[model samples]
Target chain A: MSAAVLVTAVSDNPLEDNPLEQEKVSLLALVGELDYTNAERLQHDLQEAIGPEVCNLVIDLTDLSFCDSTGIQVFLTIRKITQDRGGSIALTNLQPRLEKLFHLTGLAPAFGIQPTVIDALKVFRARQSSS
Target chain B: MTGDHGQQWPIDEDLTALRERLFQHAAQAGMRGERLDDLLLAVNEAVINVLEHGGGDGTLSISQDDTYLTVDVTDAAGHLDVRHIPRKRPTGTVRGFGLWLMSQLCDEFTIQRIAGRSRVRLRMLLHRSPTGAASPDSVSGDPGPDESWARSEVRSSPANGAGAHVDITHSGGTAPSPQQS
Candidate 1:
């Protein structure tokens, strides 16, 4: 009955060994509920995907049905790590429930939130272009 | 849900089974959308607190009436200190959201420790009465005469967190202040 958190890498870069050859952006889609039981797993997956070269992280929560305080803690941890490395974390495709949670926790301003994955990517692209 | 008078589930070290049961029961009780999610999150957080800090195991008893659903989580460890309950959500730290979030999601939240066992009670308004107001009787945790099943589930022990006595009750609006602390 444990909720599964599936972290799928959506980026096209196939470079396995060379960090310089890989794209700087990492797009990860989180599927399933991220709660106390699976929050640590999701954090591990996200951390593993975010290497030194991958600064910008885009997380698609399209298929996520449930999240609690534990999930939020993990997201905050990842956001802090990403920000410290001069990268940004964007959350896309949030369900209305999650949006309400973000709003209630007063954490909506802590991360980049977009309506769609394309929009999230555009935000990262815009940030990159400006720099 | 309301169909079951007083269903009791054991809160184990692995909360997966308990969580699934609670989710399905809540969904069956007509809670939908954000309200349902809120209830689940609040209850899950309470259960997590029990497992993490309240001697590693507890009992979750769910009971409902026409206008409200009530969940009572009881654990042998009476570790909750009313004074330590955060009045506001903590900032710059990620670990303190459980109790605060539970308070924010439920219409009525209470923590009580009598003797040695601790009980965290959560009540969510199911719907407004026909007069467009919540039923007044729903405010009381007093179970009806016939619904004694939930009351029977609570057991007390003298050795678990002995001498700790606390009664912290919070009722009314569930919204926290707009500003984070």
Candidate 2:
């Protein structure tokens, strides 16, 4: 009863590691780095890659190196987007810098920052089975 | 050869130009690849801060030694507080991430007041041959000062220090009165 896209990415680019991924999620979308210079691209890619079929979205960022306020805004926007579509989002491998960013911005509690990609995927599967 | 040269341009806007200069030097000294891009990002953010907040009516200078690249941005503004600004959500919500990213990316970052000008100097180490020249736009950093600090640490030189200075003029800057203060 759902659809999805799973992105495995690597990046030295500020916007994302992969610029060509576009799919729906009864699945997870793993992305890294969403800065002002590239937030729109991230949004477009995310929207194109994610959907209601994917009950839980997982963003793996163990390899992520940076983010600014614009990047944080992207997170808020995506969270709201997933919620409206009757789905959820989870972030794993949260780097120390990213962790500090979340706390500084008062968004730590609002995000489901898991410890690892494995945990995030497990949670999503639980959600899928429960429904 | 990459920027529209003029006086009083913001650093955020001139990162690519400044970095082009860096890449040229780094290449001659044999630097290349993602490392160059990373260095550019770190330096660009810092330069942008200098351009935007460090002073007014300014000219920045850049120099490269055998192993390190030195960039100085100065203007006639009051001394900038170099202390780290805690990472927090944007208060203005208008995309102000310049200084924050600079601090995150710089290795041996320092901000100080010198000769009536604010100076921010950043260094990045070179470990690759100059090839696949850096893109005109990009930024990156880490939690260590190894790259930056290494270059600045070798200070017991027998000769003069590499050139580093900037001039900023504001209050009716009548073509700058020649006053050596």
Candidate 3:
């Protein structure tokens, strides 16, 4: 079968009482394959998920089987948008192959990558407290 | 040289069918896991390049041997300049990563302009034979003799300049022949 990209969203902190912890973090779980054919869809889904109100974002890629340069492009686009809106983005559960791709392209550092969703959330939380 | 393992199909607008076909062929040829994914991604990038810039459509060919899996994507537009493929685009750039990623994923990547067509060849090493001995089933089909034709109009390598030397040849105004570079 041809490759496909499937995305689902999980919200952990939708609303917080404290303004410091108020940053809404939406975790997007991606599966299947991400390539030129379906990267645009992923980008659209991501754009739709994060709005002017929703800020902090974490992409869970535990089940992602494949990703190409187009996929990486989507990540860059999202990062730019999130930064422009005064938000943060992180990625968690990257497979070894995907990690290698980021490393080869020298993007590992540019992206906020953690081992798990919790760790990614922690990163956002740490930034909130530090700010 | 064309082998029995080689197959070609027309490039479609979305390239979904092409990706599926290439995936199945690579899997049947013994590629699995990340390697298969890499091959698919590389071929997809090449095909996308053709569809987006080279022309609206092109042709894709898949072939394999015991040690290497090869794919060739050809387009009518000869606008691609291989030497200009950037290894990394400035951060936040959306385009220009397809060719770079293909070069990184495949063991060898070469682009040639022949008879007003842009042909991109990508080869991935299936497995390294420790003894340096060819597998008995490696040469399953007759690839025919290699014959020289018109010289390539332009040829370019990745920034790293890795892999074997590629030879570009066309047969009596027919389909282009495979070269081991």
Candidate 4:
């Protein structure tokens, strides 16, 4: 009985989500590419999306596949801006490698990188509830 | 066409200018991930350490040689612990993370306690298209702080401090990595 088949996983997508009507958490889901190619746009988008009223900003990276210095700068810049505005920021669905980078750099404790959007939501809710 | 090489702008802002120039060069050289951000932030921190800690004026040299874009900061902050980190986090210890962040950014980073002075050197590979860092030079010298890299001062938030985190992901960026391990 010869019965065996092989399977391979293929994904060309840049891990991201479509722009949904962000509420409760005010999502700023970045799609396309997030490296130097579009990092400036990412920074601009981030700054524009954030306002004094926005207390919670959830950046969904489930669809992202790449990141460069510009992208990192955007994150750093936005994070600073968010703090200055007295708001909370969280990350959801970060890839494993990205997760490791965060941990190794001692940034894990500063940013909430959750496995899923649902998990991020929980963390955000808990923070809100307590504060 | 004269040859006088001493004061090229006031020594005060030179470090910040040097940092920005190198950052642009590194970005152009295609250094990625924590390396780029880490280099920029760490350079500033290190330079400020020189200024605030050592209270000395210095010049930093940055060049993109064949395999790596080198940063050599020659400053007077030789007395401080260039490589040591407090094992236990005492509340409000600001001096540690500047050097700490520098360590995490470069592939081949060194803090050499050279003759009479210190030389902090940072080497990041000339990666083809950004996104990932190349392998580190195994023979990295003083892991604490290169006895030499180079210096500058800039205005901004304390990079390693402030306790803020923002999510980052590259969308349709440049040349994707050859391997995804």
Candidate 5:
């Protein structure tokens, strides 16, 4: 009935005003369920948010109550896009059930999950520094 | 065991109502927490599979017993092959996760074609609380390959496509009566 998923994005480093580096890191907090019914809409939203300049993505699932295989497919598609641009994606605040789904599908390693958004951002920073 | 304890819902172009009905029925059945979430997700995937691929219409029959809650989704499009569903998780990222997910979430998964309609049956073990109400248990994780299909049964006859009359009982689990005309 209502929107199945709500995507809220925040620029992690807004003060770094370089055009090429501006908004490269985005923190998307997902609220509500993501399933086949609204997977396409969420994919479109994520694609729009992940522009050419934007690279690393941190998805916060603190309020995400449910996710199906279709929902997982959306993240996989975004992961490929980010990886192709020499960037990575991290997932934060996964509920236990969602975490179990990721583990069951053997996608935890591919997504680089973290306990919190801050920890995920730190990992991205570490990766950038090392590279 | 009788008509008083079970319900059926039609799966057509609109699934919003079907989902709501499921949530209400499942919650009233005493299912809570992630276990409820798991059942909803699994059944949602099954219904969507029917709409997207199985001639766009079907029926959902839900019944529960002392130890298991069962949902049987049957569609007129008899194209699904239980053998074709991926047993192991697919290595690719984008597709091929829906059927696998259905199998993984439920305690027993089975598919059989009857009278030219394909039916996918999903059964989840009901954990009872101290007061005898069904509730979620602490068991959460991947059951691995061996455990996922612990009580699955797939019967297909060569002459009738995927239709084979196989006994649909597992340790006292009752067979859902055929609803086809």
Candidate 6:
């Protein structure tokens, strides 16, 4: 059977009343495999997750066991979208294999990668305070 | 050690199973860690190409010798233009990196057309100890610029005169350094 990729929107936190938080960040987690068979689905899900009101995003890839060129493309597309909207996206908990891929393709510095979701959120928080 | 053995499987949507099988063989051959992951990823990309661009159905055959592990993915359809395989796509482009990635990961990659069938062959050198005791001069290591295995083309005479011919073409020369990308 063809391997399927699972995408889940874990949480969307607006932090409306908090003085320290300026933007709503949504967390999405990808699991299983990502390849040509499910690349389009991932693109759609990412777009749906990053609506107008929800800009800052964190994608948790700790559970993603497999990813291919198509998966990389989805990440690139989302990065473009986030940049165009004056928002940012960070990735957390990348498997070593996935990390190798980004390194090989010369994209390691393009994505904001963190060791944990909280660290990723800190990145956004830092950016907000600096701006 | 077993005089070179091979196994074949029909192409299907079960990429996970295919990857698992390839991993099993690589592990059996004493490949581990990053090297094993590279082998699996290269083969996975090639097989996916066969299923998507070639006919929906194809076959994957894997064989190994003492020095090299090889995989051949064949499809019934032919006439694939292997000359212009791109080494890299424009930055931020999504769909064109499969072939390039496969080339980067394998020691040698070739495409051949025989009797209306197209086969993509990928070869990776087996790992050896740092001491180079396994094969001495045959110690498999990172590909270098002067390596002749970078690229070549071969043509064989038709078999049986039934319009069956083999035209083999190598992929591009050594991949650019990762920094070039």
Q: For residues B1-181, what per-residue lDDT tens digits would candidate 6 score against the true structure?
A: 1125888888887778788899998788778887678777778888777777787778888887767787888887764435434544336554547766665565566666656877777776674445322456665565433233324322212221112122334454444342444
**Per-model C-alpha lDDT, please?**
0.70, 0.49, 0.69, 0.50, 0.70, 0.69
- How many clashes does the backbone of model 6 have? 2
TM-score of 5: 0.76
DockQ ranking, high to low: 1, 6, 3, 5, 2, 4
The count of backbone overlaps in candidate 5 is 0
lDDT of 1 by residue, B22-89 (tens): 77877777877666777787788898888778987788999877766788888889876333345655
Interface RMSD, in order shown: 6.3, 11.4, 3.9, 16.9, 5.3, 7.5
Q: Give the per-residue lDDT digits (tens) of candidate 6, residues A11-77.
A: 4443334432244577888888887677778788778766666667789999998888777888888
DockQ, 0 to 1 scale, candidate 3: 0.33
- Number of the top-ranking candidate, with DockQ as the measure: 1
Tens-place lDDT digits, model 4, residues B2-60: 01211122124344355556667777778765556656655655565555555566556
Going through the candidates in order, their DockQ values are 0.41, 0.11, 0.33, 0.04, 0.25, 0.40
Model 6: residue A81 alpha-carbon error in angstroms: 2.8
What is the C-alpha lDDT profile of model 3 across A1-131, one tens digit per residue?
Answer: 24557777764442233342354577789888776777787888878877656667788899986777778889988988878888878888999778867865668887898888878777787787898
Native interface contacts retained, candidate 3: 0.34
Model 4 docking category: incorrect
lDDT for residue B16 in candidate 3, whole number 0-100: 63
TM-score between predicted and true chain B, model 2: 0.51
Candidate 6 chain B, poorest ten consecutive residues by summed lDDT: B155-164
Interface RMSD of 1: 6.3
The parts of candidate 3 lying over 4 Å away from their true place are A1-4, A12-23, B14-16, B87-94, B130-181
Per-residue lDDT for A31-50 in model 2, tens only? 44444445566766766666
Candidate scoring better on TM-score of 1 and 6: 1
